[model samples]
Target: MTDLDTPAAAPPRAGALRHAAPALLGYAGVRALGLITLALWSAANGKSAHTLLTARWDSLWYTRVAAFGYGWEVRLPNGDVHSNLAFFPLLPWLERLVAALSPLSYADAGLLVGTLASPAAAWGIFAVADHVYGRRAGVCAALVWAVLPVGIVQSMAYSESLFTALAAWSLYAVLAGRWLTAGLLASLAGLTRPVGAAVVAALWVAAITSFVRERSTPPARGAFGWRRALGMLLAPLGAAGYVLWVGHRTGRGPLGYLDVQGQWGNGFDGGYAFARFVGDKFTSFPSALAGVGLTVGVALVIWLYVSCVRQGQPLPLLVYSGIVTALALCASGYFGSKPRLLLPAFPLLLPLALALARLRTSRSAAILGAVAAASAVYGAFWLNGSGPP
Candidate 1:
């Protein structure tokens, strides 16, 4: 059988359903409660829950992009340029496509995008977990992801879920040796978010590793070596091509997107810019406390990356995690959103999911259900009031 036709192996599944029941039930129940509570919360806050659910925040931005082609820009007091061009094109492109095919408005199209992408993300989470750990781990990973407070984003008209869905599937494809699929998805991911580079890096690492591994092995009869090598080469092309094209259009080099990010108060400054911002946060006692909290958070992120690497996680996971953590922490924009920005890292979801999967079914369900409930409420309240997380 061809590699593509070979059934991908799953972790031990004998007791997986029992182990995963609690998480699944809890996640669904809590999210349902959150949806209701959030709507009520929005109503109480003098914002129409209907409007809150249907409009505002990044949703508005995406809708605008879909309704009108790029060219809008807002010059902030800080001289930052908040431009339509800053948004990667895929989400809006999807919105446009969806809207064209149906009676849905752009906003509804975005909601549809998030709704569909969330499940895809869950599937990717399951596939990756199954590949790396076991079926139990995979089940737990999907539940954790599905129930995360950030899961609220998945229900809204945002791009994170979409980007994550693409990234996760691309990683899965690469791990399964479907290089072209990996590249195609990675390209779509790139069109979705500026941080798509992380996905590209993961694919590249996997390809290079595969290339080296195949080289060291004795030739096997009937092995499609040339086809496999070509597949590896194709994986990173999507992101690279888009970025280069963006550069071409902007009259900048292929790194034009990075320049665009800088114009919007974001860029990689080798951590120096973030340090300066953190230093300012320490000037006031209250802010200093917040700064300390952020310090602990950054430390935890570093720890997670180190732990994943030490625990024999896949190289693609390590590469993606390292890139995302670096990008979030070292980012020069709204550093407060660092946690949310890295939410799509997905690798961090594994250990906790594995732990939950090991729990007694009833107890695990109760615990995870409670957490999911809280997360949903928090997600709703956050979205209704403060915009996107």
Candidate 2:
């Protein structure tokens, strides 16, 4: 056979297997080790590992929503309504679906979804990295995400992993010019979290940039025309519709979601609130020293964004990453829980992934192993119990 026909006729199975093996192996190792550490930590703390990892804090809320279906509300001392409507809904919906088919309870179903979604999110991140950089960079990006201290949360009964999976794939779809798919995924991502704004913003920016570029380059075959652009416009429909419907039910406007978050002591204030809080922390002696330490930490986040921009990352990534970072930092609510809230912004892992990619494979694996172990242990406390307030 001719070389062209020979290569084309080669078995696709081996190639598919080869491509899938590394991602599967790497993600399995990360999740297995993380779960082990979480279990051991729960044992040490005299808590049931199942309950600790699957049924606490926000996870409990999600489980309750899935099992009971909203309508349960309590008037808090602060006069706020604590109801399932306060949550964005996608996670609970998944949990309910899983529970319906599986032997597992709603809480366990939530856990299962989170566990599966973690590796899926990692895979999506790898695809984005590979597309943006190269295969080596993709491996490194997945490794960084796999071993992140807060990544364990992604494996618990939380929406972060699911949201990340949706957002990453949505970003990849946008980059690939699959407008309808991107729009649908973006809508689902928005249904997962308030920060799904990042996904919507990324798609809008990508669409606008593509329109501008098309003005210069001659129209390519099969390119998204205005019709595709209109589909992209329809993406925010899911998120907006849900929020507005909830608001209408509650006799609140489209902005009612923000008002609800405010009841929980959160809102977006353009980083001014965070600045004032940091300033006040410096007014006391010992607290001033602590503020200095915290400033160093914030400086690292600033440096990461600066470095990413300097490296000339893709516009969609830069825009999405910037939105996530700004939303997390400038959010005027629950300042103490900012880290947890921002955990799904996997783009922040990119710089660190690039750095890790420079190391030998074995060395990098060892380092990741150690960090994953530690993160899993720390995650037990962080996910199950109350974090610093």
Q: What TM-score do all the candidates reach, one by one? A: 0.88, 0.90
**Candidates' lDDT values, in order?**
0.74, 0.77
- Pick out the ten consecutive residues of candidate 1 with the lowest summed lDDT: 1-10
lDDT of 2 by residue, 35-134 (tens): 7877877778787878767876788888888988866666898778767677888999999999899898999999899888987888788877876776
Tens-digit per-residue lDDT, 3-95, candidate 1? 331224434765644544544454455556667777777777777655565476667878898999777778899877887777877888899
The reply for model 1, stretches above 4 Å from the true place, is 1-30, 77-79, 387-389
| lDDT of candidate model 2 versus the reference | 0.77
User: What TM-score would you give candidate 1 relative to the actual structure?
Assistant: 0.88
Pairs with backbone N, CA or C atoms under 3 Å apart (clashes), candidate 2 = 266-333
Worst 10 residues of 2 by lDDT: 1-10
